[model samples]
Target: MLATMSTFELIDEASDLGQAVIKSNVYQHYLLAKKELQADPDAQERIRKFNQLKDQYDEVQRFGRYHPDYDKVSTDIRKIKREVDLTETVSVFKKAERDLEALLNEVSEIIARAVSESIKVPTGNPFFDNMSCSGGCSSGGGCGCS
Candidate 1:
């Protein structure tokens, strides 16, 4: 059976994945900003520090499955929330949320298509003349099910 997860759990997993993406984006953005600003040392260093924190989170996210501290990620999120002022984190988190929402929409459409494709109808057969099949399989033999 496919593992069943609540919507919240799925959201959590996607958020974790998004965390990595957001960190990379911020780091790249920081690098660009640094170059454009002609090596503004303080700004570059600050972004670098922030990127490192995000990187640390990404590291936990990447290898959590292999460690006893697998649960540390969720705990770490709580810790960060408690320790850091969230004025900045929200926008980053919001961007991640939006990205995740878009991806989930695409995933949902794909799953819907897959489900739509899975329902197979039998071939044309005179047996189903009166079988009420929309496929025009009307015949007295009826469906093989008969």
Candidate 2:
């Protein structure tokens, strides 16, 4: 027979899992990359400019194509976004961030599957989004357990 955990014990176990994740290589890499990105003044300036232009783009979006500055803002944001993305520190940080996110998603899926394969785990991946139905439910919409 399997032993059941009390609520406090479950909370403790969850905390332990969180600590383990923080100690993981993926998480460590993410932190180091983030730190490097923050320390890079050029990258920071590019990111700031990109965000400022993005805010302008959001405001212009309210008017759709009618806004006079809409096209300019859109073009500027795209250019700055490319610059930000091309920065070595930012690129490394983004990859590390994605890696960390994937690791967390995998852990969540494992825990959810351990309880029941039918339990829907919100994996950020679009490919596996529809694969949550393991019990042979034929519905294309999803497991439809909700």
Candidate 3:
């Protein structure tokens, strides 16, 4: 039988896991992609313009259709958003970000499952959303659904 770990030991193990994750390839790639994105002048300009347009859109959103420049601002925001999304640096950074998120989610799921299969883990995927607890505790599954 395995010996139970003290709270301090558990916390120490968690800290080690965190350090390992920071040094992982997925995280490194994400950092590199982010750095590249920040260094890209064109990409930065596009993102800046998109944010400026977004702020205008937010202000006009409060007035809805009553705002005079609402339509124009909305159109500009959409156009700028498309341009920003199409930028190669932005695209690479976004893909890296998603990959890093997936890695973290997988690690979280693993840790959760180690404790209990019924533990809910946010996977950022819609397909497995309802798979955490198929039956409630009242159904005799003891899945901690209370």
Clash counts for all predictions = 6, 0, 0
Weakest ten-residue segment in model 1 by summed lDDT: 123-132
TM-score: model 2 vs. ground truth: 0.81
User: Which portions of model 2 miss their true places by more than 4 Å?
Assistant: 1-5, 127-146
Which lDDT tens digits does candidate 2 get at residues 1-146? Answer: 56567877988999999999999999999999999999999999999998888889999999999999988988888899999999999999989988888889889988998898778666675554443434444466565633
Cα lDDT, model 1, residue 108: 47
Q: What ranges in model 1 sit over 4 Å off?
A: 1-86, 117-146
Candidate number that wins on TM-score, 1 or 3: 3
lDDT, model 3, position 65: 92
What's the residue-level lDDT of 138 in candidate 3?
45
Write the residue-wise lDDT of candidate 1 on 39-118 in tens digits: 44444454555556676667777776786665766576565554433434433444444454444444444545566944
Better of 1 and 3 by lDDT: 3
lDDT of each: 0.51, 0.84, 0.84
Q: Please rank every candidate by lDDT, starting with the best.
A: 2, 3, 1
- After superposition, the stretches of candidate 3 with alpha carbons farther than 4 Å from their true spots are 1-5, 125-146
Would you give me the overall lDDT of model 3? 0.84
In candidate 3, the residue pairs with backbone N, CA or C atoms under 3 Å apart (3 or more residues apart, or in different chains) clash, namely: none
